[model samples]
Target: MCHMTACSLLSYIAIAWLKMVPMQTIRSRVQFMKISTLSLIFCASVVSGNVSLKYLPVSFNQAIGATTPFFTAVFAYLMTQKREAWLTYVTLIPVVTGVVIASGGEPSFHLFGFIMCVAATAARALKSVLQGILLSSEGEKLNSMNLLLYMAPIAVVFLLPATLIMEENVVGITMALAREDTRIVWLLLFNSSLAYFVNLTNFLVTKHTSALTLQVLGNAKGAVAVVISILIFRNPVSVTGMLGYSLTVIGVILYSEAKKRSR
Candidate 1:
């Protein structure tokens, strides 16, 4: 997480220096506070997602992640009172039902891991919705890049204490690992860079479209991840599990069409 945030800060700075994005500073203490609060949500989403992957098969984890759209819709309504078309709402039924069905068929389901994955998905959805609501005003609003520029550092600050308390001697462990395998350093760099791009694209997507739309699109990404992980890891999957995943993908398609029509 620290590496990712460091990469984010440096990349944003370079982008700003290159004149690709305006280097806009936070306008006031209130704006800083707003971004700080959102950073906490971002941290929670990233941390929980990473932690869940420790105990859950990647395929099963992605399967649970497909539920983000349902949580996004709920959070969007609660936070912004924004309503979507009736058809759009209807489409989310299969999106949610598929996860419950998949869970029943999962071969190695861990209760704690399942809860963490759900928390991660919900946190992601909540962060997106809150970003739209909290930063909607002209004065408060920031471009995606600029928002991340401010957010990345604040998130690192928020995570530092948690890291110290939760994990002992992380720095020493990382140093020892790096000494043993030089490839570890490169791998960390590659992973952190990829994470940086993922976050950048996420913010850009939310900026151009609605938050719910971003999460709807994320459903497809999750499905693709499920397939790739299954292929690479050869994770044992039941017929019911595949069917449930398929149902979720179908629901995402329907939701996309419903959104297009409404638009």
Candidate 2:
């Protein structure tokens, strides 16, 4: 694998290791089941979304995909009945708005592609809520690692069925990727690793920072993913879209710094 893919993969492994301790203490039935349940939903989305993007335009995909944190805050508000820091909601609005503005151009309305990205955001949002909730739970004696022990295998299981069933050219794609685009193989691996890191970071930062911080970072991840994709794949962009992205990044930074200062 190349440096980018390898670095991404290593980040995930290190993050996973960080979760080992907290997960070890997870003994309660409810916590275990909750962990399993969240892993399945979120990881399934990550896999499906990744697969969809292989067929879909990267710009369109990332644009829709960026709204994840909005869903996250909504889920957090609903599930826990917890009041979010006002700045969290403020950061979220521009994040979703920027994504919508960015997605306005082309890519013939393939509803299938759109649905997958929506599912991705939904899954991510709910998973964030679950992570926030789990972090709030203690006395189980484990660290965030405890959650990953159950989550990792569950995530693998979650991805397997959808991948086999949904991906039409799974066999062809696999072979072609193996021979022609060996890098696609590395990309898939790195992508999955990033998904896992997303989870681990959600747990870690949720503890040290506010749910707002995690949500903001999640939005940033989408931005970073989009920028990286544009750089690597040369995804098409317009003046308006680029302007929106710039504003979105600036807004997110301001929002984060404002919240951080408040804290």
Candidate 3:
């Protein structure tokens, strides 16, 4: 996480130095507040999602995450009072129901993990909703890259203190481990660079489309990941699970067509 933040901070500096995005783009306090809030939500969601993996099967985690569209729609309506087409809401039912069906046999579920996963999913939805609303205003609009630059530093500020408090001998352990596995440093660097792109693309999508749309897209991505895992890892997938995933894909397609026709 530290590596991720450091990479973003360094990238932000480089971009600013190159005058690719003006430094003044993030000067407003209102903009800072919005970015900072998003940073906190993003950081917390990531941490909780990671921690949940210890107690819940990956299937369960994915299932819960598949509910993001539901929360996104709810929050979007609550915050903006913007009602989507009735078919849009109807489509989310199968999207969510299929995921639950896919993970119905998960045996490693725990209460804490379930709570954390739900929290993480809800936080992700809330972050998307808030980002869409906050950035939509003419006065608050910022280039997605510029917003990421500002958000990364604030997230670092919020996460650093928590890391210091929670992780014992973090620096000492990291140094000792790195000495035993020299590849650790390179792996961390690669992970950090990847993390930057994830954040950058997330912001870009939200900037270009509604948060609810992003959530729907995320479900499709999850389905693709499941297929890739099954193919590459030769993992066993139950017929029920396959059926559920098929339903989800079908729902996504129907939803997209519904949206297009509405437009």
Best by TM-score: 1
The TM-score of predicted model 3 comes to 0.84
TM-score of 2: 0.71
lDDT of 2 by residue, 1-263 (tens): 12223333444455456433422445678877887887777565766687668666676676666666567667877898876687767876786677666556443336677777788878877886787677676664344555555566666565556567876778787887789878887887777566556556777797887777775776677677777887888867787777666656665666666566666
Q: What is the per-residue lDDT of model 3 for residues 139-164, given as tens digits with 9 covering 90 to 100?
A: 77866676677777878888888888
Model 1 ranges off by over 4 Å: 202-217
Clashing residue pairs in candidate 3 (N, C-alpha, C atoms within 3 angstroms): none
Worst 10 residues of 3 by lDDT: 100-109
**lDDT winner:** 1
Model 1 has an lDDT value of 0.82
- The estimated TM-scores of all candidates read 0.92, 0.71, 0.84
Better of 2 and 3 by TM-score: 3
| Model 1 Cα lDDT, one tens digit per residue, 1-263 | 66547656676765766776677778899888888888899889889988998888899898788777789889988877899999999998997888888888888788998899999999988987878766677777787777777888888888888888898998888899999998988998888777777766777787778765776667668888999999998888999888888887888778887887888
On TM-score, the stronger of 1 and 2 is 1
